[model samples]
Target: MSHQRRRGQAAIVYPTKVYTDSRGSRVETADMDNPIPVTAVFVPQRSSRAEVAGQQDIDVTRMIVSADVQGIDSWSRVFWNGSMWDVVVPPAYHHGTRHTRHYTMDIRRRPS
Candidate 1:
C-alpha cells in the first residue's frame, strides 16, 4: 500500500488500487468508509521544545518527538482529542538566571 499525499494536510495511508475487468471501466474509491483527516505533527524545535509546538496542533497522538534544549531543560507534549490539540503541559519553567531550573511537563493521555 502506498501513501496518498495532499497539500497542506496529512498523507493518508491508502491500499493499492484495484483494477477490475468489467467492460474496461475503471473506478477509484477509498478502501476505508469514513475517512477522518490525519496529520503529521512537525515540531521545528528540538524534542524538548516540540512540546511547545505540539500544543498548537489539532491532534496530539501523532506528534513529532525530539529533544529541544541542550541538556533536557525544556520540552513540549501535545494532547489530541480526535478533533482538537491542546498543550497538556506548557514549556518547563526555567529560571532566567538561576543555575538550577524547575522543569515540569504534565503531558499524559486523557483517560481514553
Candidate 2:
C-alpha cells in the first residue's frame, strides 16, 4: 500500500494507507497525494562511571524528596513488593496523574 508516482518527468511520493470499513470486516487501500517529511534528532550518550554515579545520586535525592512529600513512609529499595510505594497512597487508589516532574539537566555544566 505504498508507492512512488511519476507523471511527465515529475516525481511524487505518496504514503499509501489502509482503511477499515465501518463493519470492520473489509479493508481498503488509498493513495496519498502528498508525502510529508518527518525529521527528528537523537543524541546517543557516552558516559563515564563518574557521570553515571552523579546521575544516580541526583535521582536518589529526588526520589527521597518525592517519597517524603507524598507521605510515602513505607517503601522498598526494590519494586514489585506492595509496601514499597504504599507509603504515599493506598494500594487500591493508585490511579490518574500522580505528582511527578518532567525534568532535564544540561550535560554541559560549570565546574563547581
Candidate 3:
C-alpha cells in the first residue's frame, strides 16, 4: 500500500446474479451477503444542486484505492460513510511508481 492516508474501509457491492425471465429478459439482484472490502481514501470533489422536475442535491466524490482492489466497475456501487454511492465512471488506473500505483474513480450520490 502507498503512504496515502486512508479514510476508512469501503464496501463495494456487485450484483449477485442475473436471472433470465421466461420472456428472455435479464434481471439483476443485489448481493447483500457479500461485499468486497477495501481500504480507500474518500475526497469530496464537488456538490451541486441539480434542477430537473424537482431540485436535488448531488454530491460527487473521488475514491482512491490500491491497484490490487479488483472486481469494481461502473456497474458497482460503493457503501461508505453510512450512505451508498453510485459509481459514475469506470475506474481509472494510475500506474505511478511501484508503491504509488492505485485506482481512482468518481462516485455520485443524491441526497434524499
Candidate 4:
C-alpha cells in the first residue's frame, strides 16, 4: 500500500538531547532543531493508569512513517493531537515487496 493512503495525520518529530544537569541528573530536552514534519499512521496500542504518584494516564501508540522520513530515533519526541510522546524504541525498518519501505516504532506519552 502506498504510504499516502495509510497516512492519517500530520506529526512533528522533535529531535532531543540528553545531558547531565549541574545536579548530575540526566535530562531530555526536545526541539534540538526545527521540528520535522511528516505524515504518519498512528495506531493506539494500549493505555493504562500511571503507577507513579501524581502522574497522569499513560498512553502508548504505534507510529508508522514513510522510509523517506529521516533523523528520527529512540531519543526523538513526537507531537501529535496536542500531546508530546516519547519514542520508546528505536525505529524498526521494514522492507516490503514492490519497493514499499517504512519504519515502525512505539511511542509513549507520560505525565509531565
Error of 3 at 96 (Å): 3.5
Model 3 lDDT per residue over 33-83, tens place: 668777788888999877786777889999888888666777677788788
Candidate 1: list runs displaced more than 4 Å: 1-87, 96-98, 110-112
Candidate with the greatest lDDT versus the true structure: 4
Candidate 4 has which clashing residue pairs, if any? none
Off by over 4 Å in 3: 5-22, 26-30, 49-53
Could you give me the TM-score of model 3 versus the true structure? 0.74
Clashes of each: 13, 2, 0, 0
Per-residue lDDT for 65-109 in model 1, tens only? 122222221122232344223234443554533323333333333
Please, what are the lDDT tens digits per residue for candidate 2 over residues 1-112?
0011111112121223456778887553323343322111112233333455354311111111111122112221212112111112121222223443211111211122
lDDT of each: 0.32, 0.23, 0.75, 0.82
Pick out the ten consecutive residues of candidate 1 with the lowest summed lDDT: 65-74
The number of residue pairs in model 1 that clash at the backbone is 13
Compute the lDDT of residue 89 as modeled in candidate 4: 87
TM-score of each: 0.20, 0.19, 0.74, 0.74
